[model samples]
Target: MEQHKYSISKWCTVSEEVVKRFDQVVFEGEKGDFVAFAKAYYKTNEIDYPKFFKMDALSKLAFIGSECLLMDEEFDKPTSDIALLFSNASSSLDTDLKHCESIIDKDSFYPSPAVFVYTLANICLAEVSIKHKLQSENAFFVTPSFDGDLMYTQVKYILETHRAKQVLCAWVEYLEGKYKFFGYMVGSYRQGELEHTRENIKEIYRR
Candidate 1:
């Protein structure tokens, strides 16, 4: 396949809010209302979300953000090599806590199955794929800390195998209101930038 790297195909960015709202509908305050809070910037006097959809805030953000980026793309049947890779140091600690809290009291322990799902980082991918119909091969890895090298290798293998036309890679960690999201899409689009091998991905963050 032809390698094109330098050119950026599509790109967009969103944010965490004071509360995670679904479809602009408000959600519980504890999970990090950051995304919800950020909604204010986009909301105007004439436009506001009818209801927030916290169903899967993480994935919802990816779906909405990625789609908005590719809105004007003119690629021919573009396969979303746009793989999704997310990392969180907290590793769904909040979700686990919520679940444990549910069963902590044997007297009235009842775990909320819905909250149980967000405990895993990969759920973000599921939501993004479901929303955008992106079936590209991808992964979700967790670490005590961020290691750019680890990310580079995983992305490299995907490109080498022709499994991805591009990658929507990122670092999305959430615990309480204090969370971090660092992501970008990589692929062959530049006239000569497409040779996105392991080193290419690794070297990306070097500068």
Candidate 2:
């Protein structure tokens, strides 16, 4: 059997303060709040997605990070062949807290269907998939920390199993007032700028 090799074709990181792509700073802002930073980023880039304002912090972060990473890449394969693999430490706790607060008081209870929909961390994946028209296999994992081994293994498995021709993998987290999102595109062909390895994933994440 021929060995299959995958590479990280492109990557992007978005936080409360900056948005970076391929080790280059694409956008920076003074806002210390995650929500504010996301809005500023969308505005600065002239993004007119009305649904962006409705997303929770986690989804917003994922959407922006994925958008930045896919901005310049051309997909020759069917969108359905692109898989989405994302994980985070906090999961959807940030939105869970808000949802809890909304229903904590019965007298002043105000349950919002819109807000309730974002309680699942995987909603971020849905938002990205919807935007990019990606109808592919996807998974969301929650770990105590960023597990490079798990991510590396999963991507490799997906490729080997022919589950996907490409994978948009990311670690997007939002907790308290801090937020961090890092996304990369992976594929079997060596058309990427970075080799897809656990070490390389960690290095770009740290940057």
Candidate 3:
């Protein structure tokens, strides 16, 4: 058996602070609820996408994380050749609760199409794909926790099997009023890149 090495071209973490490539403090805003933080991050950063406001909390987190992860990185392949692999524990529970509440009261049941559309966790993947114009393979998983082996294996397979030239991996989880997003890019080796391994993935997630 042999192992193939891939590089983590870049990564981003969005929580109380926005850290890019591990330690660079790109933006740090006042601590607040997820909704407030998302709004402040988007507005303060001047991300020119008005559609962001329409997305659900999970999608919004994924969108913002993807935005910071893919910033200024040139891809060698077309957008269609990039694959998205995202996993989270909450699995869109935040939006699911909203949708559930809408239908729970039959007397006043009025489901908004907007709210119903984001019931699935994978919808966040779609939101990111649409925003970045990525037409490549994308999948989302719900795990008990952030599985580093899952992230490493899935990303490695995507690269080795030629399903994509580059793979964007993320662990975007949002439930209730808490959120954490960790995203990274895995691809062929490049200068100053971190090797894509299970340990590395866990380390980055912890950071």
TM-score of each: 0.68, 0.92, 0.92
Q: Tell me the lDDT of model 1 at 168.
A: 70
**What 10-residue stretch in candidate 1 is worst by lDDT?**
19-28
TM-score of 1: 0.68
Q: Please, what are the lDDT tens digits per residue for candidate 3 over residues 1-207?
A: 545468888888877645355657787767766777788889987888888999998898898888887767565554877899999998988998999988898799899999999989999888888777788999998999989999888988888899998898989999887888889989998767888778888887887
Q: Kindly report which residue pairs in candidate 2 clash with one another.
A: none
| Minimal lDDT window, size 10, model 2 | 69-78
**At residue 150, what lDDT does model 3 achieve?**
91
Kindly state the number of residue pairs that clash in model 3: 0
lDDT assessment of candidate 1: 0.56
Counting clashing residue pairs in each candidate, in order, gives 29, 0, 0
Assess each prediction's global lDDT (C-alpha) against the native. Answer: 0.56, 0.87, 0.84
Residue-level lDDT of model 2, residues 87-194, one tens digit each, is 999999999999999999999999888989999999999998887778899999999888888999999999989999989899998987888888888997675367
Q: Estimate, for each residue in 31-90, the C-alpha lDDT of model 1 and write its tens digit.
A: 446555435433521223342255444544444444444434444553565677766577
